[model samples]
Target: MSNLIRLIIGFALVGAAVALFIFGHWGWGLLAVFFSICLFVTYFYNENMLIAQWYLRKDNMDKAAVFLGRITNYETQLNRMQHGYFNLLIGLIESRTAPMKSEKYFKAALNLGLHMDHNIALAKLSLAGIAMAKRNKREAQMYLADAKKADKNKLLADQIKQMKDQLGMLDRQTQVRYSHR
Candidate 1:
């Protein structure tokens, strides 16, 4: 189900729980509350992710960050796939501000297993960008290769080609500089 639908259902459950409590049905009210809490835990990360993506699509980085930040202790609350996506979201957002920190998040997401070729490719491509920025040509090349392999849909073809061209240029420049010395 969509996050919006889940959120509506959760709110309904909470409202019903409150109504039941007010009517003095203690047992049913407590049961409703328990179910509502479970639903909240399930939907919290999903809803935040949806909102964060919307903000990101609008280029509202600050707003996106705020929404993403609302998903606290996600490692425990979320399932494996969600946990991986949570880290991926954090990595993508943080890569703009704190690059070094983003690397760890990306790696964590990868280790947790994204389970999608596109997502895995994206993470690897981001790692390649990080490696390139740090002037680690070999590491960048490794990541680029992995990204290419993981991109079964060829969604990252343009980016892979661009990075390859950049790496080639860097290699030529390095060779020329060394030869002139």
Candidate 2:
């Protein structure tokens, strides 16, 4: 189901829990609370991620951030793989405005293990971009090398090429600056 429908159902379950408590059905109320909490947790864990990813795919940053922002208590509730994906999504979102912050999220996702070469490669590419932005040429080169290795399908070949060209241009610019000094 869609995230909106799941959110509505979750709210409804919370209301049911409260109604059961008011009607003196203590046991049922407790059960309702448990189920509601489970539903909420499940909703927080899965639905937002799916919806946010869809928005991200469409390059709708505002919509994607809105969905992703709905998820709470990331560190405690999410499992290892889920946490990785969560960090990856957050990293992607932050990459445009705060690349330094995005780099940390991407690294965390990588350390936690995405288990998908394509995702790992993408994260690596983001890291390379961040490194390049920071003028960390060595780090950027390392990340690019890692991304190249992980991109078995060559899906990111164009991106890799662009970054490589940019890196070369930056290197030449730095070389000229140093030589002039």
Candidate 3:
């Protein structure tokens, strides 16, 4: 349906431009046609980006990666597509059973050359979570602190604060238990 609408609108604009040229209003018609073309291109790119993001968020990492890879090929100059690719890599990392593979994905995301605040924060948080899982308190704290510094969302800020507090408590508990041994 949307494709049909786009087709209709495209033809309508072209027809209007032709009509205007025939009626001696060529300048306005040409401008309208140019603007319409620009609008269509922008909309197409944004729609593809949104689809990539949706697939990534849904945990369909393979599909998301494919889509994002296609987008990157289609728009070589668009850095935002790398953001989508990084997010898919993050998802892939989170799904891995092995810490080494997970770390690889996290590092791959970092190497993507795109550093939106949220994406960077998410990568840091993922690393922090992995550190916590491995009982590496110092590494977790470092990642958590980086995540906190990269925070763009106040809610995420609060969540990170709570996570740090929980991690601290866990560390204290571990120390106490080991000390009693």
Candidate 4:
């Protein structure tokens, strides 16, 4: 459902709740208020994305992908803030099968902007990994630096350290090739 429709439904429920209260149906008014809150929550969080995230937490990409795929047109279905997240989820799922292809999605996610610092760090880290895979050491280094900066809570500290180690290995590999030449 579109975010606008959900907002309208939420307002309608609020009206119903007000009506019930005025009619002395306190219990039904409370129920209507609860349902309205749920609708408002979905307006921001997006039901399909929430389900997909749940599956992702379980490391079930296939199921997660299915739920993500349900949002045929995310621009209409999701809130403005959720645009980045939707792309981020797609990128993560695609990375498992096609790491290179996922790069665009990651870029889109970054461009659209995410709400959380950790998610921003995750996207940058993923981009750094992609750059490393492509043997673009300079690009990888930049992304790693950005990822480190974005990871304000140290949530990706271990992964950032590991990536830096791998980048050092890249440096060694190049040195070895130069020595052989």
Candidate 5:
């Protein structure tokens, strides 16, 4: 359906360009050609990003990672693409046999200073998870607090709060166990 719509629109634009050229409207024809090219590039670029996002959402991290890896040189202007790459990396760490290696990518993203809310939140969340895994409660809490501050999404905030509570409970349990021992 989408392909058909695209084909119809492409033909229509080409027809308009041809009509303008036949009418001796060189400027209009050139403008139409430029517009068509712009539209074509924009469509594919957007489509690739959407595909990557879809794969990520479906938890098909390998496919998402492949698609996202195909996108290079366009990251400077495509914050979402960069975010998607980082997301794929995080997913791979979560589901793959390899140990989680996302800290470097997350730190690089943070260093990019993109200020994208989602990216910042994800980076912080990743760091928080790492901290919690290492039993660094203070650092974990700090990262979770920072993530909560960076995003106003209630879901993310709630998740951070939950993580904090879990960490607190774990800490208390560890202390109780150690003291009893």
Candidate 6:
């Protein structure tokens, strides 16, 4: 549903609740108010994306992708603030099956901009990993630095450390390859 339509429905429900209150229909008024709040909630949290994130947490990428697929045109279905999150979820689900293909989604998510610093960090970390796989050490290091900066709460401290360690291994492999000459 479009954000405008959701807003309209929320307003309509609130209007109905007011009319019910005026008529002393207390129970119906309360119910209408509850539904109105739910409609408003969709502005910040799209149901499809929320369910997809839940499936992701459960380690069920198939189910997560299915839910994300429901949003045919995310621009129309999700609010501006939610656009970044929608892309982030898609990137996460795709990363499980198609690691390289997920790079674009992660890039889009970063471009769209997530509100949470931790989410930004996760996307950067994923990008760093992708770059490392492609043997782009400089790009990977840059992304790792950005990811470290964005991870303000230390939520991704372990992952960041691990990535650095992997970079060290890459150095060792390079040294061995050069020493063979």
86-130 per-residue lDDT for model 6 (tens digits)? 988988888888989999999999999899999999999999999
After superposition, which runs of candidate 6 have C-alpha atoms over 4 Å from their true positions? 19-27
The most accurate candidate by TM-score is 4
The reply for model 2, stretches above 4 Å from the true place, is 1-45
Query: Which 10 successive residues of model 3 have the least lDDT summed?
Result: 71-80
**Who is ahead in TM-score, 4 or 6?**
4
Q: Which stretches in model 1 have alpha-carbon errors above 4 Å?
A: 1-45
TM-score preference between candidates 3 and 5, better one: 5
Query: Which parts of model 3 have CA positions greater than 4 angstroms off?
Result: 1-49, 58-84, 87-93, 96-100
- Candidates 1 and 5 compared: the better one by TM-score is 1
Off by over 4 Å in 4: 22-24
Q: How well is each residue in 5-73 modelled by candidate 4, as lDDT tens digits?
A: 889999999999999999999999999999999999998898999999999999999999999999999
lDDT of 2 by residue, 1-181 (tens): 5546666887887898889889998899888778777677765567678889999999998899998888777665555468999999999999877878898899999988888899999999999999999999999999999999999999999999999999999999999999998
Structural RMSD, model 6: 1.8
- Per-residue lDDT tens digits for candidate 1, residues 1-181, read 5556677888898999999999999899999889888777656547778788788879888999998888777765555578888888889899889987899999999998888898999999999989988889999999999999999999999999999999899889999999999
Of 5 and 6, which scores higher on lDDT? 6
Model 5 per-residue lDDT tens digits across residues 1-181: 1434555676678789999999999999888878777566554445555676788779787787676666564455354545554543544445344435666666666765535686577678777887787788888889998888887665577777778888889899899999998
Give candidate 6's error at residue 3 in angstroms: 3.0
Per lDDT, the best of the predicted structures is: 4
Query: Cα lDDT for residue 138, model 6?
Result: 97
Quote the positional error of residue 119 for candidate 1 in Å: 0.8
Question: TM-score, each model?
Answer: 0.74, 0.74, 0.59, 0.92, 0.64, 0.90
Please list all clashing residue pairs in model 6, or write none if there are none.
Answer: none
Q: Give the TM-score of candidate 2.
A: 0.74
Clashing pairs in 5: none
